[model samples]
Target: MKQFWDFGMEQAKSCIFPVVIFLSLAITKVIHLSLIARYDLILIICLVTQVLMVVTKRETWDEVKVICVFHLIGLALELYKTHMGSWAYPEEAWTKISGVPLYSGFMYASVASYMCQAWRRFDITLGNWPSTWVVCALSAGIYFNFYTDHFIYDFRWVLKVATLIIFHRTVVYFTVNDRTYKMPVALSFVLIGFFIWVAENIATFFSAWQYPNQEQGWHLVGIGKMSSWLLLVIVSFMIVATLKHVKGKMKQAPKLKTEKTSF
Candidate 1:
């Protein structure tokens, strides 16, 4: 029994990323209708796994702090947007957009755990100069509002394949950078999420886009969601900050012997 437990842990440690992917896919499927129902269990499993691993690590304080910033920022932004009627998801997941349930935080963390791992493997860095824009543009191209809100839930099969490919490549490219200051990078993900939040609100305001059943997602304050657009640039700066910190650390050299000789 102990050996079996050890084996399981080893496998989990060795291939947690693949496990996360498998978990998200398995979670996203829930046929009988409700958004959180049938689909919520997968989120639990994914988060439980990350929690176990994160607890085992000693240096998680900074990471947790950054994630908390994301959570607060997300909640505030969502509450602000809830006033606008810009976008919505199945209300089953939330009693109020202003008060998104706690599970939402866990959901973000679960996906974020996988993203941190992927970014490390991709070697993608703000240090790459203009290449950083490529990541954002590509993410927008693939994760377009229309597809995730409508297509993935119903016509999931089509999305499954494309997502698998794109997500795999994205993880690979981003995870390539070994010298990473994790907190900033994680915050960038949160910032990106915020950008998406604002973007959806804008589209809905213009009547350029709308989701079929969701009513719990899009919300901004009296200001148009466009007001939050600057967050995207902030996110980019955060990424660059992480790159600069990591690069500086790497370039720091150990002290060498220096002596004053006596005659």
Candidate 2:
């Protein structure tokens, strides 16, 4: 019971960024602001929340870099996806480009923020990690498929199979408190994806954005979206993993140089 309580607490702590985003969504939905658009207001709130996190020492500058990279990646995807009519942001806002609000990218950044925080708070490490080349190729493929699928064949299933094969042996080790726990990397992806899917429903409920079918009335997002989220979570994980790996190597370089000089 104690361990479960501690684990829940840590998970909540890791979710602070996402919680702030969601709260902004809900609050802006209820409050009417004529001078400032809701979408722009949400963007401001997200920016302020990020700055506060950094100022409070909750997130490091290095992690902020990772989040910024995700913000760009997500914004690009949003531009393409909105152009393709995957979804629509109905509200007008100054921060919108091509009908997509800039705040939308922060939605993706929140995911990266959660992963970064969880990695630190839970003392996470990967076992039997794949080679860098394989991981990079897979991540690239997963990302491009989102765009290419609109024209060519959808290879999500194939990518899912590839992901399973590539990560079958990999395990994520995380500490809850004093005891360490382990889970399959693939399973973790699915779990995170599921929760994100739930968050999606909440976001849409507050009119964050709407699918074509959802423009009429609110309904549950399709279960199929969970698979999309699962693939996305994998991409997010790979980005975070790559950054951490690079930082680890950078730290080791100084030690190696000193050792070589001494020898």
Candidate 3:
């Protein structure tokens, strides 16, 4: 019981960015802003929130860089997906490009931020991690399928199966307080994806954006979307893992130099 409580507390701490964003969404929905557009206001809030996190030592610069990369990746997908009519930002804003608001990318960034925070707070490490090339190949396929599927065949299910096979042996080890816990990496992806899907429903409920069906009225987002989020969460995880791996290698470089000099 105590371990569960500690785990929940750590998870809540890791969710700071996402909670701020959701609150901004809900608050902006009901308030009237004369000078700034609602979308632009949200963008400002996100930027400020990120800066504050860095200033307060809640996030490292490297983590911020990773989050930025995810932001761009997500924004590009938004541009294409919106053009394809998958979903849309119906509100008018100066910060919008080709109908998608810039703030939308931060929604994706928030996911990366949560992963980074949780990793640090939980002292996370991976076991039986796959080789770099294999991980990159799978990540690339998953991302490209998000685009290519709209034009050609939807290879998501194929990619999903591939994910399970590739990561079947990988385990995530994380510490909660003094105790440590482990879970299958694939299962972690599904759990994070499920939560993101729930967050998506809340975002749409607050009129953050609208789908075709929601244009008439708001309703629960379909369960099928969880599959998409699961794949996306995998991609996000692989990217963070790669960056962390690179950083770990870089940190060992000076140690290797010192060892050689001592010999």
**Regions of candidate 2 where Cα sits further than 4 Å from its true position:** 249-263
Each prediction's Cα lDDT score?
A: 0.40, 0.91, 0.90
* TM value for model 3: 0.94
| Candidate 3: tens digits of C-alpha lDDT, residues 151-207 | 799999999999888899887877666555667898899899999999999999998
What lDDT does candidate 3 reach at residue 254?
17
Pick the winner on lDDT between candidates 1 and 3.
Answer: 3
Ranking by lDDT: 2, 3, 1
- Candidate 3 scores a C-alpha RMSD against the true structure in Å of 6.7
Residue by residue across 1-263, what tens digits does model 1's lDDT show? 65346534543454463345354544354234454543244446545655666687621554455445544544454444444554433324433344343444443343334334333333334322224354445434433332344434533234334333433322101221122221233334445556446544543443222343324443443343322333333333334334435445213321222222100
TM-score between model 2 and native = 0.94
Cα RMSD (angstroms) for every candidate in the order listed: 15.1, 6.8, 6.7
Task: At residue 186, give the lDDT of candidate 3.
Answer: 87
Q: Which window of 10 residues has the lowest lDDT sum in candidate 2?
A: 249-258
